[model samples]
Target: MDLATRATPLATTTVHRAGRLRTGGAELSWHADRTTTPVVFVHGSFDDHTSWDGVVPLLPPGVTAVRYDRRGHSGSSAPGRTVIHEHVGDLVSVITELSGGSAHVVGHSYGALVSLMAAVRHPELVRSVLVHEPPAFPLLTGDPVGEPMRDAARAHVITVAEHIEAGRTEDAVALFAEKVAFGERWRELFDGPQRAMLAANARTFLDQFRDPDHYALDLAALAAGPVPITLTVGTDGPPAVRRITEILAERLPAATVHTITGAGHAPHLSHPAEFAAALARHLDRTHLDRTRPA
Candidate 1:
């Protein structure tokens, strides 16, 4: 059932459960709403499983949305080290344990990168992928058109790093919000709980950012993979992010792009209904494609 046609409120209808998974030497906190089709959600840096609260409840009835706090964030164990490959392993483990080995994946920002890498590394375990702007900046290295964007990102990184090193995590989070996530009107966009969440996970963001290979992707491997990918971009998102998504669509043969009008980085937070509807469509399309004859 679509969001509008559904009579019962998700609060009353969805069954929520809490669970744990051990991966990459960290005990990860996971949540699931028991249903027919598993749809795992991967949240970006400086965020946690609660990031999907707005969207998951609104998803169609059959989707069992599973979301977990990544290592070093929220309830997960913080090992003081964050690596992209470990995150990919964590995602695969999550899928294996919670989703019956294969499931549709949806991710935002850094989580998007993890989900894409997981799809490439374990195509047999991924049904399909829906990702918002992944900060795969390495893809822009040699492109002349991306030089300016790269420069701007580097500057933002420097400033954010300075704040983090100075032990001003709140300041770093605010700077990130103003510059990348929410733009000029960030103060109005982020609420107290959301801001607290970002502030709390600030150090993890720095840890991930410092990893040299965190933003790298093997485009050739992803292109050759069988898993279908959907790259989602918000109309009001950062220009660099939009460019990265554009480059990804150009490179990945089995990938498609979708835009959410007037939304920014966290569309699931800012535009839950639209995001949920888009996910529902993706779920339907993947099911149809898999069931269709060759």
Candidate 2:
């Protein structure tokens, strides 16, 4: 299960719909396998569907894995306003159209926040949710721990907005990759190719930053929902992210939390085998329960 090699066979394509506009005219791209239950993949800020490039093929034969560019990112429609709720709406529409019903959802980083919101809002449309390192800082109560991290996230968002307004997307991406993505491990985890991808998608990354609601709205609703969720934090993730996972596991009803060993914020990219194995196990458990005598 060499993740880099597995990524090669995964195909890419764009999706467009004229009748509905969740994110003010949505455009999406995805990777699919015709034989499986559709698995929708959502990426965080600064990346596109390709972020899942390293993990898509590792999915079993019966799962159709789909990843999309967030509105205003990559080939997706560029909406004038960006917000987390809007992104969640876009996901609902996309999932409805692509999966023909509720589907299994996997979201990474900020994308995880969006997916959680969708589950909360449209629980009927989601069978199971896998959220990897969602930054739900404002919602994590009982913690003075999140105060500094939340402030840092806020400042980082402001910095990104300022840089983008100043037409400094490259610098914004660099800073985000260094300060947010890999954090202390930026030098060790992000290779030449990863850096290139981040640099290329700087504008979209900045879109999320300029609009604080891109994360805030989702975090607000995550605490109120009853959606069944699987929360994952990379063993090497930032302390804040790990704390958020702990909060969800402790607070969210019907939620399970797990940590991926030897992985960071992006385990799907860094340790595809372990990531896929975890997913497979989750899917198996859920599927069995759904079919059990009731």
Candidate 3:
């Protein structure tokens, strides 16, 4: 119940490069502490490390949490091309370099998809992955609503892309806020504070949505790969996010799917306490599982 203790300030570290990879050089910003195993935070599309502002304070003691402005966003270097594999490779480099080999990876939205790819491609560099609403449709093949959700996601991406190309980032962002971020009922929920946060990070969001390969990756294949994974969806999240979470839970081996009550897509931001508590519990359980007698 002591939220104060969970609100420890995470010290920011300077940006560092993780050797040369396919996308030239990938850089990351890290926060290290003396006690905890490093937990790398990956931001979703249209956002940067700042997206983790709320949840950072809630992370457990000794945990080294790192967030990077995935290539082309914020302070990180952008190498022109915006392919998904390149982004995945950037993640691989960051994790391997920062965690000293492996890390507990947490990703939201598009970042979740990248995290899955990194885990699968370089399993040795990932201990466990906490994927929050990865938009992988094919994995939910059996679900009646799966196809529709995928179609919607695709359509949304295309619409946003066109808007961005036409130099209408504001319009694209507004439309996204209406249909995706705050759906019908919750539109009113994003009053003063939430709107401020969204507005501040609007540019990054626009850039992410406009990227060419944002929706081109094979999310299902990435999810099916061998990795200890945790899937989380907010109870009040959009139907598409919930659907994606369900599909991931069903497809991933050794995966646990959870719905955080009274939260939305950005639970880490909207409900920091609940988000931190759930993450802490998951990390504890994961540690126990790893040390348990086989």
Candidate 4:
């Protein structure tokens, strides 16, 4: 995929407004308002909450849209050797402080796993969970059918780490672009924030990969849990990512799946209006607006 071929057909603009929230040990930078049923957005690996900028305004004006820099991402404090628990704990505190202990949540890629885990660990804090293409790789483990996929993915991570440890940051970045990101298409994203964010948070990606719980979760427990989850994928998304959503939907009967036509990977960026609509509909259906301030 050449960068030209993968380039967005339209020139999209962003609305930039920034503020900071004092949460736990880190002062999280965010954009939001105080409202009963706030919407909290979590960004995937190598990105910050501003990744939701284009999609946020399209959400219903009646609802509050909140996003923040996760630890180690842009605009957030970088603590030493943080793990999945710390990430989850940050979200728990943020939601409690921002939305009075309950809010609708949307997470993309790596953030999707974090959001789902938050719901699983603290259902009382979440009114709904929406995820896009989370690489829940652990679900591919143990079974004869999925074990190979797991091993291959783990090997890929290890190789990328090895490259970085060799002090070959450029090599590691290129490998990540070609292997994990969409090959030459990654260049299209590099012209903006994606490339810089990936570079800035490279070490945290290492920590995330090393964290046993980074991609590990008990799907059965989640499936039987109370919070309703909706998983969205782009129609043109990679087969592996589509498979993750399929397996998750199959396991969690309460889960709903939506395909964004003519989009891939990042729907919030590629198909902002549709993504926002889907999110608003889910929140309305779930009556998240009814959540009261704590």
Each candidate's clash count:
0, 2, 3, 0
For lDDT, the strongest prediction is: 1
Q: Is candidate 3 or candidate 4 better by lDDT?
A: 4
**Highest-scoring model, TM-score:** 1
* Candidates' C-alpha lDDT: 0.84, 0.70, 0.67, 0.74
lDDT value, residue 90 of candidate 1: 93
lDDT of 2 by residue, 1-294 (tens): 222222235533223222323444665554444433667889887777777766766765456666678776666776465777778888897788777777889999989988888887898898889989887776654478777776776677678767777888777766766676666666565678766766666766655665657555343455566556788888877777787787677777667777799788888878877888788777776682353234
After superposition, candidate 3 runs with Cα above 4 Å error = 1-23, 26-34, 140-143, 184-226, 288-294
Sorted on lDDT, best first, the list reads 1, 4, 2, 3
**Runs of candidate 2 exceeding 4 Å displacement:** 1-23, 140-142, 187-194, 217-226, 288-294
Q: Is candidate 1 or candidate 3 better by lDDT?
A: 1
Better of 1 and 2 by TM-score: 1
lDDT of 4 by residue, 1-294 (tens): 111111134312223345776655676777664333577899887678767767765665456677888888788875577687788888887788766788888999888988999999999898889999888876666656656756665676688888777777666776766566444466655554576676776777778878877887778778888998999988776556667787888898889898889777777866788998899778877875455232
Q: Clash pairs of candidate 3? A: 36-62, 46-204, 46-205
In model 2, state the lDDT of residue 27: 58
Worst 10 residues of 2 by lDDT: 11-20
Give me the runs in candidate 4 sitting further than 4 Å from their true place.
Answer: 1-18, 22-24, 33-36, 142-148, 288-294
**Structural similarity to truth (TM-score) of each candidate:** 0.92, 0.83, 0.78, 0.85
Q: Residue 267 error for model 1, in Å?
A: 0.9
Clashing pairs in 1: none
Cα deviation of 73, candidate 4, in Å: 0.7
